[model samples]
Target: MIEILSPARIERARDAGRLVGTILRTLARRTQVGTNLLEIDAWARRMIEDAGAQSCYVDYAPAFGRGPFGHWICTAVNDAVLHGKPHDLRLSSGDLLTLDLAVSLRGVAADAAISLIVGEARDAQDERMIATTEQALAAGIATAGPGARVGDLSHAIGTVLAGAGYPINLEFGGHGIGSSMHQDPHIANTGRPGRGYRLRPGMMLALEPWVMADTDQLVTDPDGWTLRSATGARAAHSEQTILITEDGAEILTLPNP
Candidate 1:
C-alpha cells in the first residue's frame, strides 16, 4: 500500500525519522571491537522504549524471512548485507558493520540504514565499498523531487555503483514507507530513466543502494534471515527515508546533532 502524508502527518513522520536517525547514530558510536551483536540490539530496544516508540522489525515476519524477526535492530557484519539477524558474534577490528533500523512513533514509520567500520583498522576495499554506497544513496536522494520518476532515482543511484565497478542487485531495493516499514512503488538500484511510478508531493520513499564487492548474487545464511554475498566479498548499504515535497524532496532521516 502506498501512503501519502498530509502536512500534519509529515510532521509526525519527521519526528519518527529523527528518532530513527538518533538511535542509529548512538548505536554507531557505541559499537566497537568486542561489542556483542545482542548487546547492540538491547541498546536499540532501550532507546526505542525510552522514546515511547515501536520497533518495526521486532515482530516482523515476511515470506523471505524465517518468522518473526524477534529483534530490535539489524546488525550485518562484513559479508552480511540485508535482513541481518543479530547473533552471538562479537565485532572485531576492521569489520564492516551495517545497521538497518526502522521505528514507528505516533503511528508513523521511518526507516534508515548506515554502514561503518567497527574499529581502528580500516581496510581500503571496505572503506571504498562503504563510500560508494553512501555516494549512491546521495545521488538517489538528489533525484527524488516531485514529478521525478522512480527510474530517475534508480538511474542516478546505479550510475554511481556501476562506475565504481560494483554489480547491482534487484532482488531487494527501496520502497514506499509510512505506517509500515515496507510499502509499494519498489525502487531498484538500477533502471531506465523516465519510467516507473511518478513522484508526487507528500509521498515518502526509502531509497537504499546496496552492493556486494564482486557479485550481485546473494545467499541466505542458515539463520534464514541474514543475506550474504554469494562470493563472500565485503558489502555495504546506505538508506534514507525521504518525503517528496512540492518543490523538492525532504530527507527525514538525517542525524540529529
Candidate 2:
C-alpha cells in the first residue's frame, strides 16, 4: 500500500535510514578477503539488536523466495545481484560484493544497498559497473519530488545505465518502503516519463538501479533466492530510501560525511 508518512513518522524513518546506512558502512569496512558471508550476517544481527531495532529480512518470506530469508543481511558476491541469501562462503580478493540492508526503528523502516570490490580491484569493468549503478541511483533520486511521476525517476535511472552500456532488468526494482521493507507503487528501473504514480510530499520510496554487464536476463541460483546474470557477467546494484518533501527529495540513507 502507498503511504504518506506523517511528520513524526518521517522522523522515525530517518532514524531507521541512518541506522541502515551506518550498518552497511560498518559491514563494508569490516569485509575483506577471507571474510565469511555468515560473519557479515552475524555482525548485522548484533548491530540491529544493540540499536533496539529490527531486521526486515531475517524472517522475511515472499512468494519469490524460498521460505524465510533467515539472514540479517544480503551478501551478494560476483555474479549474484539481488535477494542473495547468505551461505557458507568466504570472500576472496577481487570479488565484487553487494550488501543490501533494511532495518525498522521506532515503527518505521528504511532500505538501502551498496556495491563494491571486496579486497582488490580485479577488472576495470567491475568498477565501471558499480559506478554506473551509483550514477543511476543519483539520477533517480534527482527526479523525485512533489508532482513528479514514478516513471520520471525510472526514466532518469534507465537513461544513465543504458547510456553506460549496461542492460536493465525489470524483473525486480525499487519499491515504496516505510513501516514495511517493501510496499506499493512499484518503481521500475526503466519506464516512460510523465507516467505512473505521481509523487507527493511525505511519500517515501526506495529507488534502486541495478544492471548486469552483458544481458538483461537473470537466472536464479539453486538457493531459490539469489538472482545472477544469465551470462555470468558481473552485476552491481545501488539503492537509497528517499523522502519526498516540498523542497525536493531528501535522501534518508546517505552516509554521514
Candidate 3:
C-alpha cells in the first residue's frame, strides 16, 4: 500500500512521529549498564499505553517473523541488527544497542530506530559503525523530496555506508509508512540512481540504513526473530520517518534537542 496522506492525515502522522521520537529518546536516557532488554520493552509498553497510542509491534504477526511479536520495542545488541526480540539479557557497558520502535496515534503510525553505545565506550569501531549508520540515514533523508526517485535516496545512503567500509545488508531497509507501520515502495539501502518509485508530496517514508561490520551475511538467532551478523561482528542501524513535501523532506521523528 502506497499511501499519500492528506494534509490532515499528515498532521496526525506528525503527532504519531512525535510520540515515537519521544519514546525512543526516553529509552536511550533511561537505558544503562545492567538494564535488561525486557525492561526496555516494558518501559515502552507503559509509555505507549499512557499516551493512548497503539504499539505497531506488540501484536504484529508478519510472515517474516513469528506470530505476535509480543514486544513493545526491538532491542538489538552488538551483533544483533534487525527484528531483535527483547529477552532477559542485561546490557553491559559498551554494548552497541539499537532500539527500533513504531506506534500509532490517532490512527496514524510512525517508525524509527537508533543505535548507540551503552554506558562507557570501549570499542572505537562500534562508535564508527553507529556514526556511519546515522550519517547514511541523514544522507538518505537529504536526497528525498517531491519528484525525487527512491533510488536517489538509496544511492545517497549506500555511498555513505560503502565509503565508510561497511558491508550493506539488503534483507531489510526503509519503506513507505502511513496508517500502518510498513507499507509499499520498498526502499533499498543501495540502488542505482534514476530508478524506482518517484517521490510525491504527502508521502511518509521510514529511511533506515543498517550495516554489518565485517560480512554482509546474517544469521537468525534461536529466538526466531533477532537477526545477527554471521561473522559475529558488531552492527549498527539508524532510521527516521520523513514527510515528502513541496519544498523538500521534513523529518518527522527527530529526537527532541
Candidate 4:
C-alpha cells in the first residue's frame, strides 16, 4: 500500500525509525570477530523487547522467503547480500557483514541496513565496495524531496554505483514504507530521471543501494533466504529511511545520539 502518513502517524514513524537506528548502531558496535550471527539476532530481539517495540522480521512470512523468517535480524556475510537470515556461523576478521533491520513502534515501521568489515583485516576492494554503496545511498537520499520523481533518486544512486564499477542487482530495491515492512512505489537502483512515481510531502521511502564486486547475478543460499553474489565476490549494501517534506527529505534512520 502507498501510504501518505498522517502527522500523527509520522510521529510514530519517527519513534520506529529511532529505535531501528539505535538497534543497528548498537549491533554494529557490539559485533566483532568470533561473534555468531545468532548472537546478533539475540541482541536485536532483546533491544526490541526492552523498548516495547516489535520486530518486523521475526515471524515474517513473505512469498519470496521459505516460510517465517524466524529471526530478529538479517546477518548477511561476505557474498551474502539481502534477506540474510542469521545463523550459527561465527564471523572472522576481515569478513564483510551487512545488518538489515526493521522495527515497528505504535504500528509504524521503519527499515534500514548497513554493511561493514569485521575486525581490522580489511581489503582495499572491500572498503571500496562499502564506501561506494554508502555514497550511492547518500546520493539517492539527496535526490529525494517533494515533487521529485522516484526515478531521480534511482538515477542518482545508479550513477554513483556504476561510476564506481560495481554491478547492481535489480530484483530487489527500495520501496515506500509506513505502517508495514514494505509498500508501494518500488524504487529501482537504476532508472531514468523524471519518471516513475512522483514524491509528495508526508511520504516516506527506504532507499537502498547495493552492489557486488563482480557478476550481477545473485544466488539464493540453501537457507532459502540469504541472497549471495553469483561470483562469490564480496558485496555491500547501504540504506536509510527518509521522510519527504515540503523542502526536502530527512533521514529518519539517522542514528540516535
Q: Can you write out model 1's per-residue Cα lDDT over 95-173, one digit (the tens) per residue? A: 9999999999999999999999988747798988999999999999988898999999999999999999999999999
Ten contiguous residues with the weakest lDDT in model 3: 248-257
The TM-score measured for candidate 4 stands at 0.98
- TM-scores for the candidates: 0.99, 0.98, 0.98, 0.98
In the range 7-95, model 4's lDDT, one tens digit per residue, is 99989888889889989999999999999999999999999999999999988998889999999899899999999999889999999
Candidate 3 C-alpha lDDT tens digits along 1-257: 89999989998988889889999999999999999999999999999999999999988998888779889999999999999999999999999999999999999999999998899988798898889999999899989999999999999999999999987878799999998999999999999999999999999999999999999999988778999999999999999999999989999997656
For model 4, which pairs clash?
A: none
Q: Which ten residues in a row have the lowest lDDT in candidate 2?
A: 248-257
Q: Give the local distance difference test score of model 1.
A: 0.94
- Candidate 2, 1-257: lDDT as tens digits: 99999999999988889999999999999999999999999999999999999999988999999889999999899998999999999999999999999999989999999999988899999999999999999999988999999999999999998999888899899999888999989999999999999999999999999999999999989888999999998899999999999979999997655
The numbered model that scores best in lDDT is 1
| CA-lDDT, candidates in order | 0.94, 0.93, 0.93, 0.92
Worst 10 residues of 4 by lDDT: 120-129
> Stretches of candidate 1 above 4 Å error?
none
C-alpha RMSD by candidate, in order: 0.7, 0.8, 0.8, 0.8
